[model samples]
Target: MPCDQDKLAIDDSRWQVAVAREAVIRPLINAGQLSPIDVATACRILGLRRSRLYALIEQYRSAPVTSSLAAARPGPKKGARRLAVEVEAAIEEAIRDKYLTRQKASVSTLHDHIRHLCRERGLDIPSWKAVRARVEQIDRFKLVRQREGNKAARDRLRPVPEEYRADHALQIVQIDHTRVDLFVVDTIYRLPIQRPWLTLAIDVASRIVVGFYLSLEAPSSASVALAIHHAVMPKAEWLLARGIELDWPVSGLPDIIHVDNAREFRARALARGAAEYGISLLHRPVATPHYGGHIERLIGTMMGAVHMLPGTTFSSISERGDYDPERHAVMTIEELERWLTLEIVGRYHNEVHSSLQMPPNAAWREALDRRRAPFRHPHDDQQFFYDFLPFEERSIRRDGVHIFGLRYWDDVLSPWAGRLDRQLRVKYDPRDLSCVFVEGPDGAHWPIRYADLRRPRITLGEHRLAQAALRQRGVRLTDEQLIFDTVEAQRELLETSASITKSARRQVARRARSLNAADQGAAAEVVAPGTKDEPETLPVLAVEEWS
Candidate 1:
């Protein structure tokens, strides 16, 4: 049988194409310009059978070219389309409305619905196979997305080829925060703390990890600023401090930092500080995972490395079942910090990146060598530190400057004390509640310590937590009350163990950090030991802020 002789459905436009080919070849056969074998070859090209070729040739001699090329009318042409137009309309409507809405409905269900709908309309019905064929024509992507949701849509959208091309390093950088999937102990207490949070910055072009801040404290503006500060400055001092000899050449003020819409990223302090340095922040769209994928992948890599160490809270319950992370934990936060630094600078940087098919260090060096633009940093480290501190406007009262619930005073503030007309601008580090800086109308900043200097320093977070804890105990602490009680609260948490009570993980981490401080030296302020959560923000002010 020839291809044209075995006719397809009239609705299949290919049938008309076959008919047109026969029309074109019939004239050649009739004009005697072609021999029987030649005609047979032409019919073969036209997909006409030998018998069909002779029939079409005879029909073509008596009919117009247009008539010969037309496909025969399909269905019982004498009746109403083999089924009423209303019945076909009902089947189509059932497919779009009934079949598409169901997530797991089969074609048989669609066929039954079509017949049911046709019966209600008092119209003729088509075969179940005909209705099932209509199901095949449904657009799966659109149907699945409507029934299943964006996640289904997103899965199909992935494996998208890379259209992004890069010319320079830091053309765009992505940043994200993740709580490490591992439990680490305190250097002093040896008690496992909550998994530390890591704020990582990644350079897109070189696939270089610019810098990261790890803290026992939750994700906050201070940690982000600390990370960005390290990102923008020279790595020599940092690398030297870590006693690391490896070259970490990737450091510069990125023009833009892409991050999620976290409260930390939207912090006014970060915004103001970034604006000063001409760095803009772009917030990734909510629920859009791909936007921050670079840093996310880097985090996964870091976490994967950490999982090999003892105390890892391996990602899933199945992986972690019967495994005790706290009991198995060995490294302290600071040790992990150092270990992660070595991994990033030594292993991660030296290893080949998937995107560039070259080591990150090499890519960074290549970009730098190609363009020797001067590396930009703040003129002064202290100033860069100050620029990132959270600030607010407050009027100086006779009692001196009070923020939240604590009073800050310096004899230097004696002059500004009792002055109500002046709304002085004040900058504060939340990590320490012991002191604050007040911007005098004379363009000078006065450093004011807590009115009671004898008291041990505590962080604003610790202070707030203490006050809340005290309130729960029906005790209200006033400025006149012994401020040292708050410091005791800090110690109570730091000195306590979670081995028995299994206290809240965050509190356990807070306590461990405080103990580490005491071990290092019970200074007015204790600096957390740095970890892969790098850029350990030391206590410039008394008190401790846990990661």
Candidate 2:
């Protein structure tokens, strides 16, 4: 098969004929039973024998794409080296040292260089056509990057098509984050807090929402990780936990995750985790918004649904005139999440997608029917969740491994204590400081708890707030006890004032959600590794009113 089955050269007449053949046979295959007359008609149309026609039908059934029927090319097979080893090496050297440089040398110059080198080695000179073919074989992005520069390559070599294509389910999934267009209230106060951010993943082939993460906090690496974790793992248990009965069967490690060039999307944690799970990450060009058109459309569709809810902001001031979202806000963040889940699995999946021309669920099923093998899923659920989390390297001492002013100790750390040769990698969920995972030498992550077992589990946000409070009181230096005490005091204050103060209520609500996340073993509370306490400002989106 070709490396890129979806793309075919414009002048590839054989592939074009195969594509036409596929179109003629597709309906007959769909009908399942082929009569003698149908078979004879298909054989006549395709200029093939009965046996060859049956074989083509089987091939098409296994992979219902035009490329599946592509005939083997004449001459040297793909990736075959026809020239002598020394001559090929000379040609490669010439291309690398001369052609692929900022000097912008032409193919003729490269061919001449290759000829001269072949003569120097007393080898036969290859044709200019072979040299040009080798040059064309070099990746376009790499070629442009070497010859022009990174910026030019990025700007000039993006896909020109308006719609991103995927041949099967889980082939290419797009993940993106957007602030929901509704104001959700605090669970206790029943008063509006703020719009929550939603990190969503959509399968490009079927337009099915594979997974998503909703939070009151802004989008971060943690959001991306959580979203991906949800995307890759089965949703049966998750749906049952949420009391949702709808079947959301879409779950698998996507072949490629397409994303925009946001910092969270580009985080080292995400890149490393993707590599660990055998998933490819494709970042769209810097200024190419259309490259992300599929996800953007999905987001828009979701927001359009949101506009029907009680506390909807209506997407623009003009549309929201004379209406206050806060006064009408009814659902809490958790409630909003549940509502979105119902909206997705119950309605969106069943409803017809404009692009797919069929319901997403149906498209998913059809794609699955075409596949010879099942989609890939993570084997270890817990480890998959931990892999995408931001990590820190900490040295283990006699007492424990110290991080964020807290010490974590477990029997597992005993073996690696006091080792100056290397620091162990510790992965923690920012939502819970009760435990951290210390990676052992054998690549297994050991869960290490706080040295003081009695210390209550607190979120990174709460910890940061307490630290700020301590600094305000002129406590320049502090200990674990001091930090926990400050956190407890702050929580007490927030609880006490929650009924009267909106800000206090918001904080209390956020804390409750954080504790819930920690209980579910969900790591990340919008804090990326190596980032400070303050959150980055979200980019302002232009108004995209519903048509």
| Residue-level error in angstroms, candidate 1, position 350 | 0.5
**What does candidate 2 score in Cα RMSD to the true structure?**
15.3
Cα lDDT tens digits for candidate 2, 38-138: 99998998899999999988876665545557675766444435788888899999999999999999999999998888888899999999998889878
Worst 10 residues of 2 by lDDT: 1-10
| Per-residue alpha-carbon lDDT of candidate 1 for residues 1-547, written as tens digits (9 for 90 to 100) | 0112212123335444644564465447436655787777767787768877667666544432222444567555322235567776888788778776746677787778777877787777788877766666565666776667768865874334354334577767788889998887755557676688888888887888898877788888877777887787778866776688887777666757888878888786676556444455677655778877788889889989988999998878898889999888888777777798999988999898887899998898787665433444554454455566677878788878877667777667777787645477787766555667776654345567777666555666667777776777777755534335765755566556444343444565665464443233212222222212222233456668899
List where candidate 2 sits over 4 angstroms from the true fold: 1-163, 473-475, 522-547
Global Cα lDDT for candidate 2: 0.79
Q: After superposition, how far is residue 223 of candidate 1 from its true place, in Å?
A: 1.4
